[model samples]
Target: MKILLLSFILLGLYGFCLGAGGGGVSSSTSSGGGSMKETEDTKRLREGRPLILTCEQNATNLETKWTKDGNELVAGDHIQLFPNTTLYISTAQKEDKGEYSCKTGSMTEPKIFHVVELTLQKHLPKSTTVLENDKLSLSCQVQGDPELTVQWLKDGEPVEDTDNSTRLEMSDNEYDVPNAVLSIKPIQKSDSGNYVCLISLYSINVNTTTVVRVKDIYAALWPFLGIVAEVVILCLIIFIYEKRRIKANFDDSDSDPAQDVKNNVDGKKENDIRQRKH
Candidate 1:
């Protein structure tokens, strides 16, 4: 019975130790988190601004590593690892755009960052009406850090001007950064449509539209100005006819009046002669 009791005690102790060991292993396994896929997160940041990307963990102690796309990141003066888990970009630039992630044990979903330096908009001469045969000049302005690849479009198609092209001329002027000018020399009615100034930088595309309404030089005359001209010509003809008629009346009427005056004068003279002879 003593031997049996001792054997029973040993068996119980072994079972208890085994249970404790299994519990310890389970705890350790849970402490290391499994990799999880996340939805895409995208960010648009202004160039030259600071940004932070973080990787939070459920574990108390974690060793974190950073990667961009799939390459292990090498921290530089412009980029640094903060708190050993968070990424700090000193100044976001166009070259900084990439998919970035941090790995505690497994990579978190990548955060996409895109940096834009400029925003372009129509600057001068609001939607305008220009007379036909007049030169059309348009300006497009940009704000923020402007790095631009510019193209001018008429209606909906790209505008390409050659040396021999008579109607369109394009030039870029850089007062501070630069603005584009489209010169439509002697703009025609066909030139009337939406003129868009397209500016693109990196992955950002911006455009400004200016509607041009080309007016015929005689557009205002529509129906009224022509009518006025016809009335003037008719009035001039009537005035000339009336003046000629008055002149004819003067010549005919003056002959009768003159003859009557002369006859009266002759009769008076005859009377005087007769009196003297008597």
Candidate 2:
């Protein structure tokens, strides 16, 4: 009778332990959320990265459930729930930014997962019309990680910015977002193409394109017109010099004709007198 009572007591204790929630929290393991280089109780991931969260419990008949921000996690294209109590996130997004918890018949500490949001926000013009030699300004509004870099491209190729000209500027706005500007003092016809603002961070790149339509009036004929004006000025100077030289020669010739005739008559008279004397 004592043995039977002891068996009942032990069975009751086992049932009581099962009714209460204690074994699952202690036996469950939180692992597999980062890369091989990093492992921690919680994970900090950037957007588009992949991660896995595994759970292990001591209960045999228990089923594991995953929750995000106190809401039940659903299996979707980007999220997969495995039978081995694993939750996989294929491509992390900003929406996935919250605390993640594994529920195995008990509520436990949630692992905070930080997802770094990446974005390229810009106000781009489809087509801009400006007169030739006018100032051109192309701006892009960008909001993302500060580590993100900005690049300028023209006509599907990279722009050469080796000079680091003052035409390009990067400033922070009120919210500390990057505001990039590419300004040209005298907009040329060559600058009238598709200008691209490329923003990149990690392996993701986003760009916006704009076209500049420059109205150049007689642009090709300008050099020829300048050459014609120079030639015309040179010819005018030469013509004036030639006319002054001809006038001077004509004035010198007019004073000589009458004097030469008188001198010739006097010389002949003098010659006849000398001949008579001889």
Candidate 3:
């Protein structure tokens, strides 16, 4: 009886080992299948155009279901999901501007993708309006997660082979450094117009316009006019004073001449009479 019991116990232990081995194999197969699918997806994405992706949850299946700009994408949309689960946009256009989400299955939470909007702005250092003959500087600033290439435009034309009357200097704030200065020495009137900054990033282009008006030299002529007015007022005061003095002298002369002659003759006659009597 003891031998029979021992045999049964040994058989039960062997069956347990076999069951454990089977479970390990099943798990390995499942993991391998998932990894292969991811690799294939990455390869397909590389061969396709770039696409913007959005997800509702983190654990969603990035392989099977993908959405662009919050809209469900068709199979032929030419978008591929990578192992790292990043969505690529082959050619981004104005219509492509929106949100994206990625998901695995209906039960998984959706992961929302952050959409970065690229903007190109034409910025002047500090003062937008500068006096003529003063040093002026303008910078083309591009804001986006990915780096953008900037191009300067003047009067709706590309600025190339331009003269030094409106000199342009280019700098960057790529590493989050503030104050990207574009120095222009001696800004000119011709440089005044709508200045534009064009930025291109990964099939996306944006432009910003700034109206630059260089103050003319004649703007300060008012002060000179003020000085001239002061001088004119002083001349008028001097003329009025001289005219009054002349009138007073004439009035005194008209009365005094006749009286003086009469008084002199009477005094002389009196003196002669007195001398004779003595």
For each candidate, the alpha-carbon lDDT, in order, equals 0.61, 0.60, 0.52
- Model 2: per-residue lDDT, tens digit, 1-278? 34654555565555555433221111112211111122333454567778777765334444677787678888898899876667788887767755577766554754344333444443466666555666666666656542556677777666665332444444554346454566675655666677777766544556776766776644434445555555566667668888999999999887878889999999999999999999
Q: How do all models score by TM-score?
A: 0.45, 0.37, 0.43
Return the top candidate by TM-score: 1
Separate clash counts for every candidate: 0, 0, 20
Report the CA-based lDDT of candidate 2 relative to the real structure.
0.60
User: RMSD of model 1, in Å?
Assistant: 36.1
Pairs in steric clash, model 1: none
After superposition, candidate 2 runs with Cα above 4 Å error: 1-114, 161-179, 217-278
Off by over 4 Å in 1: 1-114, 121-126, 143-146, 161-166, 174-179, 220-278
Considering every candidate listed, which one attains the maximal lDDT? 1
| TM-score-based ranking | 1, 3, 2
lDDT of 3: 0.52
- Candidate 2 or 1, higher TM-score: 1
Angstrom error at residue 79, model 1: 8.0
> lDDT score, residue 200, model 1?
62
Report how far residue 104 has shifted in candidate 3, in Å: 10
lDDT of 1 by residue, 1-278 (tens): 34654555565555545433322111111111112222224344557888766676333455667777678887789888765466788788777766676667655554343333454433444465677777777766654343457677877787664332477877764434344777878777788777777766545565666677776666544444444554566567668888999999988877777889899999999999999999
196, model 3: CA deviation in Å? 0.6
